[model samples]
Target: MRLRRALLVSCAALALAASALAQGWLDRVPPEIHGEVPARAPAGEPLTVRFSASEPVAYTLAYGGETWEAVVQNLFVLRVRPGEHALVVTATDGAGNETRVAYTVTGVGAPAAELHVTERARAGDPVSVRVTLPEPPAEVVSVRLGGEALPTFAADAVEGGAGRSVVALGAVPLSAAGTLDVEVVVRDPFGRERTLKRALEVAAEARPVQELGLTPEALGALSDENREAEAAALREAYRGAAPDPLWREPFILPTEGVNTSAFGLPRRYAVSGAVSFHQGADIAAPQGTPIVATNDGVVLLTGFYPIKGGLTVIDHGGGVSSLYFHQAVMVVTPGQRVRRGERIGEVGSTGLATGPHLHWEMRVNAVPTDPLAWVGRLLP
Candidate 1:
């Protein structure tokens, strides 16, 4: 009789537990919103929306005066329209419990122009590229021309609220006629919505500059031995690999002196009016003038040369490098560490220079950019 009583007690406990489990099932499941959809309209060109949820929920999405019954909440993408939109989401649990939430949709402006890219000019020639937009967004993050991503530019009040950026290729040779594709991306401040796409076209080639040749007699002035040694030194200085960071610090002037020649200046040598371009700036200073390092850098080169005189080149972490020419003496040797403003040399005309001065050149990925624009503004 006692055994029968114990058996009855166990059966009663199991039934009670089953009833409790069914009652508390909803408590274990929390509210989830996973489905995402583009709040912007299809007129915005690149707008898309997405959606997600924890489990299958009987739901409906209301937008643009239309309702969509959502059998299962996975990912639903929508192309929306311009102007304000009301989003109503209704969800019902398996147990018949129901919930709803609302959000707003702000339409994106139409593309003012397709992202357009054309060869404006050539290296050493003036290049102009035109970008057309259907309707300009409030701001432009950046426009990629060719294969390069340039700085973000802002629009003026008159530019249809669209912005532009221009670059000078300057004296660099191209492998061949090139095709360029431009990509422009605009973002809406709300909801981190962004539109990105590319525009492609063949670039119009600029007229090639005629090459001026000098006879062997004219080149006799420079000693072949001296020129070979100088070439070897420069090659050694540049052959090593350097990292090109995604972001770079603004350049700084290595030293202060009188600016004698600006970059890209057409020049006539020996009163013949035979033109040449000044590739770097000449900063004339007194002999023994302290030549400081431009930024924190490692000395890649410290040597004397027949063409450059006594020169030093500093590799500043990034692909950026600075060259200081016409030094009377070099204080730092190759492989030495130097800080910004650290004296690396004394200025003197040692190479093919007219006077005591420092020829300073700033190179980005081996390409020359405007040094003044980087040096003039005091760094923050």
Candidate 2:
């Protein structure tokens, strides 16, 4: 009986020993970490490091005298000074098995400058192009869209004020329907020249056509000399733009009236069979309706003309200008500062028109755009 009892005890001990050995083997396998640390990063900028483990793990990251602990699923972000750094990570699994990883990261200066532009725009729409650099450039040599120079101004950078931003305003031509190339040339503070390039895709816009009949007096006013003179005056008014924006709020409508003629409409005169696209919107109102300034700006020009009648041109700065035409009386004069919604004129049919109305127009960098788009909104 004693021998049989001893044999049972020995068998039980062997079974317990086998179970212990199996558990030890399973605990020896540590969790595997999967990820890569960037060898180089932008100096002083936040660098994000993402990693995962084969199994759930508690991870600890050590660098630059700082320690961070979280689950392996969470990402690690660090901002290292402009130099080399040693990053060490330790991961521990549920079974007490641990794994360690180390990486060497180098922090470098800012990357090459970049140019940003609107990727897509509709024909006759305004587009904004921007150039970003680590430091402000000494001079912006030129900003060109489709090989034409554009007016540029300084603006706040998009990257949390870490760099400088130069902005240029442009418009897609009413007839353009393809990709347009943009080029920017700037001189760095060190006097080194840098050129950046980008492309903008312009979509076609289909505008409606309108036919109208004009009296002999109106037809006579549309002479070649009158048109050329009006064109020259407008060019001179838009030649010098303020380096900054003057409007402090959203733009408003110049007057309240029915929109008789929309912008970009092909107007065909029945009297002479002449066609021309309307550069502005015609708002029909009673004679002597109050007209207000679209935004805060300086009155650049106010005078009577053959085509525009009592016209007032306001420079809202930053390549934006507003025009109010066909007015019976002009309340503002050149070099006078006007505020948004302030009275500037009275509606009339003094110009080449069939009835009393106000022809309101808005231009960006000398390019006529849809004025209604600017109403109730602020632009860059």
Candidate 3:
């Protein structure tokens, strides 16, 4: 009889515990809330709304008497009409417990932005895009020309204004011609996006060419086997598009010689078949003439090659690089830090050259431009 009484008391305790567990289930598990209030939107513009919950939830997102429902709430966007409106996000769990989040949306004037191109870019010429933002900063700014993504770099504004970003659209080809279109994409902090299109008329100009008499034997002797790999390596090494000018001062010529040849004139090496551009100014100099650094930079490449001969490449940063080829002897090592007017090598005709001349080339983002343009001035 005592045993039976004890068993009955234990059963009663279990029933009470199960009753309390059933009653407290809703209190134990509740909906969680996260995410920020969106930025200001334009009048009559759609306001983008986003929020998150810990679990699957039923949500009622309301703004100005207009309501939207989400059976499962994680990421969603809702458009609301412009003007000041209170946005209420109510998330309910399976147990009917609700978590409410509120934010004030003040729809003011649309966020203003503009794009300015510094110059009319030629084919194979470097182009820059500058964007100006509204008083309230945007979350992100993007630019594109000819349907290609242009990488942008942020910079401080000159004359003390809002921040600006400069994107270096490296060396577009003549193929991107005619009515060129630049697409600017801007997104505010509130997930509202504004797209603007700017049309630029590009001029059609043919790249110049030159003819050279080179025998087939001479051309084949220039190590044609590894030429592509070497060229690719050099291009990859100097492909950086830095925002700030790596060179603080104007560039000075490396050697004392008359410019016998200029950049961009593609030399037809064979009678009718092979054509390659002369990327540098071929300045006639003595084989032992000292070759100096054009400006302050890090020596990225220094070695003898079949085409460039004894070559030395100095990276002046900001996508500007200088190349001195056909050196008799290289004084500096690769990765060496060099200064303006410092002797880095001696001019020579060690590789595919007619005589002793320093082939000095100035490249911006690996596209060869006139070295003289960069000499005695600040430029690409």
Which sections of candidate 3 miss by over 4 Å?
A: 1-39, 46-111, 139-141, 145-148, 156-162, 172-183, 195-209, 215-217, 235-245, 376-380
lDDT of 1 by residue, 149-235 (tens): 543322221233334422212212232145444555554344333445543333444332323343444344357797788768766
- Evaluated at residue 70, the lDDT of candidate 2 is 55
- Looking at model 1, residue 173 earns an lDDT score of 23
TM-score-wise, the better of 2 and 3 is 2
Q: Write the per-residue lDDT of candidate 2 for residues 145-196, one digit (tens) a residue.
A: 8898988877652223444777788877776767888898877443456687
Q: What is the C-alpha lDDT of each candidate?
A: 0.58, 0.80, 0.72
- Model 3 steric clash pairs: none
TM-score winner among the candidates? 2
Report RMSD (Å) for each prediction in the order shown: 10.4, 16.0, 9.1
TM-scores, each model vs. reference: 0.50, 0.66, 0.65
Model 3 residue 60 CA deviation in Å: 19
